[model samples]
Target: QMQGALEQHLARLNELLASRGDYVQTLKFTQQLAGSIVLQLQGLPAWRGVSADLTELSGQVAYVEYYRWLAYLLFFILVLTVCLLACLGLAKHSRCLLLLMLCCGLLMLVLSWASMAVDTAAAVGTSDFCVAPDKFIMNQTDDEISAEVVHYYLYCDQSLSSPFQQALTVFQRSLTTMQIQMQGLIQYALPLFPTAEKDLLGVQQLLNSSETGLHQLTALLDCRGLHKDYLDGLIGICYDGVEGLLYLGLFSLLAA
Candidate 1:
């Protein structure tokens, strides 16, 4: 009986020794895992504030900005036209043409100013699209680049806008609408071969495209006055191209 008890005690001692070894090994591994996790968490960066300043920037956001500036230019042109009219008004020159020119210029100027006021909404709205890295956590590509733009052109345009970039979105929606109108004109002409309707439609399209292109170009340059000659030359070309389309469509319809 004594020998049997001794054997049982030895068996229990061996089990305890094996369990203690395993516990020591497991504890060591757990400590390493916990320490690694702590280190990794420590390496992570904290949040930084995102920001934007309108006056300090000019890029994609500048497109809308330039539109605003153009109104100011229209104002300048209006003033020049006004001065010309006033000089002629005093000179007793062909008062009719002067008056007409003056009226047109003044009207255009007023419209431009009004449009400028409205476009401010566009500029303010773009602020939403502005991605401040801290506030917005996006893949680097999406935050800094517009994948749609051929160049992934750093949409350097400061969109630093409101919650949803509402104004910016609405402004873009308008551009998209203009695009749709342009598309509709083309589609309308497709079924009709050289008809008057088709001719008119094509002419209108050319004009629309020309105008949109001109607006885009002027907007692209942020109205810095650096590309006046380029814009002027392009405008003349686009105008002639549109007029030419009108004439061509007219002649084609006449022949048909």
Candidate 2:
């Protein structure tokens, strides 16, 4: 029975790790898409502000990656230290080493409890994020893009796929139609209303700037921002991280 339980726990651990790997891959893809969007639009004055947000997100992703590996290293070292102390105490029958090992084990127990508390809070926060991710996504949006429109992009699963594709198509056609209308205005209306030239010029600049935003819009319309953040938080806090904390808790109990 003990062996069976151990096997089951190990299997669950493997499954969690595999799921975490998938989340990491998704995060990498999201980072790439965000970088591309930022690169494409940041040259335009319209995109300057959002570009900073994207940069900050990318930096956060890098930090996540860094801290993940760092945690792995620390956990490995913790386990190694315990095993070494146990072996030394067993082979030499040293009371001093056993006392030191007990002291270290007690410290680990305290740390594990603290870590578990933090992880639990993080899991709760992530649960909240996953529940209403659209609100978070909308917060990152620029003034020019409506929150509803941005929501469509991040949540574009199978049901939404067709509608967004059609929206893009319609947007493109509208641009073409506006170009035709502008040509007519320049040719005929400008002759009688020379004063309208300034307004026309303003419209032209707006259209050009809109094109830059459109490029970004099409990219952001995919699952790159909020969805990624929610998934990352979900897996990082609730699954792999929490599982590791549980294992540490188990180890501390056993050591004590």
Candidate 3:
């Protein structure tokens, strides 16, 4: 749950930050509005640094996954070879093959113990995380996302209010106000300063786009989405990850 929630939040945060480009363009357009009415644009948080970090993390995950698959494949082959050698030795009554089979069986036994140890550690760690996933995620993402936002998603209870509601309200009001102002300017001011018509229309368009973005942002910030992701992640980790490890441990025991 913690891993899933963190990943979902990071992905949303990245998307929110990426929208800064449109905000920047809006700021530029707002500068032109300064001639008629003063409009102060709030600065967006820096996203490039966070984006770079996420990109690096993605690369590392891919690398790790590739190696994990390779390791599983190699282990499977090793077990199959051992089984084949045992069969060959028994059928042929060959001393050399039997000796080799003995050596492989000893190796398999050591490896099974090592694998069991690893599986135990992994299961323990996962159980620990499952106990207080929210706290773990909060600690991990303290530097990246706000505690209020994190809490809102971690415990998506009906009574809990959205952390972004106020911000979204303000954003909606601001967009409506801007759109009204732009419409008035286009209607009245265009007749007086015909040359400003192009800029006025552009600003109106930008305001519309911003309003759409605000709606999208509100949806993304909703707790249901992130909470669902968290639940799914928990299911995967608990049901699939741990179960698979147990199966592997069983196989190891059988091989030994």
Candidate 4:
């Protein structure tokens, strides 16, 4: 009877342990389900929103960074070109050519200034450059029409801001002046030769004449005084051929 009671007690203990294990498993399952629900509810939307926000911000930064790189590349190219030109000028020992280049640069600067004054963002900055193969740089400003009476300065050159108006204007005045100067030059001076051909028998004679002309040209380029005289002579003589060049010179002087 004692042994049978001990066996019965042991069986009861085993049953209780099994019941506690079941209870603990059920509680763990509930806890796991609750944790899963809370995690999905909290993390899914939060992660999605965070991911989208990060992508949007990253795209903006990338776009701005691209523009900055493009701007830097363009700046480098411009500097490289200038350096090459300087090297070429120095190697050739052509001071007169250098002066002419300087004059042209000044003229360009003036035109750029005029455009900028009329519109704040005229020569698009390096950062603003685009990769379009064909570009149209048209003067399209709404205020340009109403800007008629404004007297603006293109560097040192004073000009009417508007391309219209019957009033005193710088560009129109330049045209009139150039025409007058041309009329005087064509009145005198040699008709320009068509070609510089040479005969086999008279090679030395041709060479001697060429050498003399080259020497005179070199002497004329020795100083600014002579250079200016040659340039003034050119204004009256090469009018039809180099009208653009003359205005460029005038613009340069005005700018300087």
- Writing each residue's lDDT as its tens digit, candidate 3 over 1-256 gives 3223323433443343344454334434433443222122232223366558768987997898698679768777888998999999999999999999999888877887787777778777877887887798889777877787778778898797776666566566666765765676566555755655555566566667667776787786678987998889888877787788787767766766
Query: Candidate 1 — which residues are off by over 4 angstroms?
Result: 1-60, 112-256
lDDT of each: 0.43, 0.58, 0.67, 0.38
TM-score per candidate: 0.27, 0.48, 0.75, 0.25
Best by TM-score: 3
lDDT of 4: 0.38
Task: State the lDDT of candidate 1 residue by residue for 1-256, as single tens digits.
Answer: 3223323433343343344554334324433433343344344322222123223333655686477458556655665676777777768877786777668766755665555544444334333333242223234334443333212122323343222233334434444554454355345433442333443343345445644654564355342242354346445434553454344334323322
How does candidate 2 fare on TM-score?
A: 0.48
- Cα deviation of 132 in candidate 4 (Å)? 40
TM-score between candidate 3 and the true structure:
0.75
RMSD of each: 30.1, 23.0, 11.3, 44.2
What's model 4's TM-score?
A: 0.25
Off by over 4 Å in 4: 1-47, 93-256
